[model samples]
Target: MAAHFPINHHLRPLYRLLSALAGLYMLVFGVVGFVQTSGAEFFTRDEAEWVLGLRTNPAFSLLSLVAGVVVLGANLIGRNVAHHINQLAGVVLTVVGMFSLAVMQTEANVLAFSMVNVIVTFILAAVTGIASLYDRVGSLTAARAEEAHRHSARVA
Candidate 1:
């Protein structure tokens, strides 16, 4: 079998922890959304009922819960997969945030997205995505250097 790179870098554990925390935040927010809205609507723009400044409804809250579960799961799936998960989330979230910004004023946004939502989402996406990308690249580089050093030592 071909050699596989292990996620042994210092940042791996930190990344996992961050992901878990983010997941927890999402789960909590989702639950709060449900409690506050009383299941009266699937989507709403009533900022008065906003959770953390983002318009939410039953569907949106559910989506948050689902996302939380997935992120938490990713953290437990080992380093390699976790790195990829971060990357994927970064791209997806960034796109979603930008899209939400674009449609924030329109009634088509089912999530009742607003400026606060867009800003926060973008921050999350950028930070997670960039950090993951950096970690992956640095880890791989270090691994490669170590491998080369070992190979040269063995040949010598």
Candidate 2:
């Protein structure tokens, strides 16, 4: 599996920038949601409360803030740490999205997740996962050799 992933990919900077942007978006969304849902029950499932076009509650807002900070911090850290964090966040977000989807209409929707929230979660997950794939750090020599190997393998 490690062999299948590229090392020191040329597009790493772009992916990192995208990931950082996603984190920033999340941070802003969380803050706005937190402010909008203030004084409401932490886990209230009120559909009337929305932020950035997505339903939210205090609990969800707090969670989003934490997640955003973690992602942003990882991106700033860069290298293997960012890669690992992005991968983990992707999996976690996917699971959260799936769970939210499953409980969308029921009373268990503590997050007050709307359909759009699920869609956004999946999109963010994909972005973070893709970013992780190309965020590896390595020597240029090793990268060149690995690229050559991959090229040869493709031709064969």
Candidate 3:
């Protein structure tokens, strides 16, 4: 859709790739979480162990699974839906990253790895945010053009 509005094709691929990867990441995480909760034992102790129980939160896990699926499905849809999906994904990642950082600091004894994840997730969030804006702008241009065409056709 943005093709008529001077889009950077280079950016589209990047956005789609990031969205897809993020989706895949969440999908895998959800499946793993489900499995882990259904009686698989992990040898962990204390703070980290305590937080492991938090992963069993039905709300968080379900949200993760649904968000991942919605994001991936949006990519596969038409332009308007894709734009909105990218926007939502960006917001989710940004907030989730910040929350993860806070949780890691407070809930775990050794937060080195968690901190790394937080940093990476934040970067992903930033990239998605920019991409979302670009896509939305492009879609807006396309929509206006379509509207103009419809008006002209009706008048003719």
Highest TM-score, which number? 2
Most lDDT-accurate candidate: 2
lDDT tens per residue, model 2, 1-156: 345568888898899889988888889989999998899999998643878878889999889999999998899989888899999989999999999999999989989898999999999999998899899888889888878878874433
* Candidate 1 residue 144 C-alpha distance from true site, Å: 3.0
TM-score for each predicted model, relative to the true structure: 0.75, 0.90, 0.58
lDDT of 3 at 95: 84
Go through the candidates in order and give each one's C-alpha lDDT.
0.70, 0.88, 0.57
Cα deviation of 7, candidate 3, in Å: 5.4
- What overall lDDT, based on C-alpha atoms, would model 3 receive against the true structure? 0.57
How many residue pairs of model 1 clash at the backbone? 0
Question: Which pairs of residues have clashing backbones in candidate 1?
Answer: none
Candidate 3 per-residue lDDT, tens place, 1-156, comes to: 233322334367667667767676666655555454434333222322112223333333445567678777776663657677777778988988777677665534232225555676676577656666555434557667655654564433
lDDT of 2: 0.88
Give the local distance difference test score of model 1: 0.70
Root-mean-square deviation (CA) per prediction: 5.9, 2.1, 8.4
Where does candidate 2 have its weakest 10-residue lDDT segment? Answer: 147-156
Candidate 3 minimal-lDDT segment of 10 residues: 43-52
- Model 1 poorest ten-residue lDDT run: 1-10
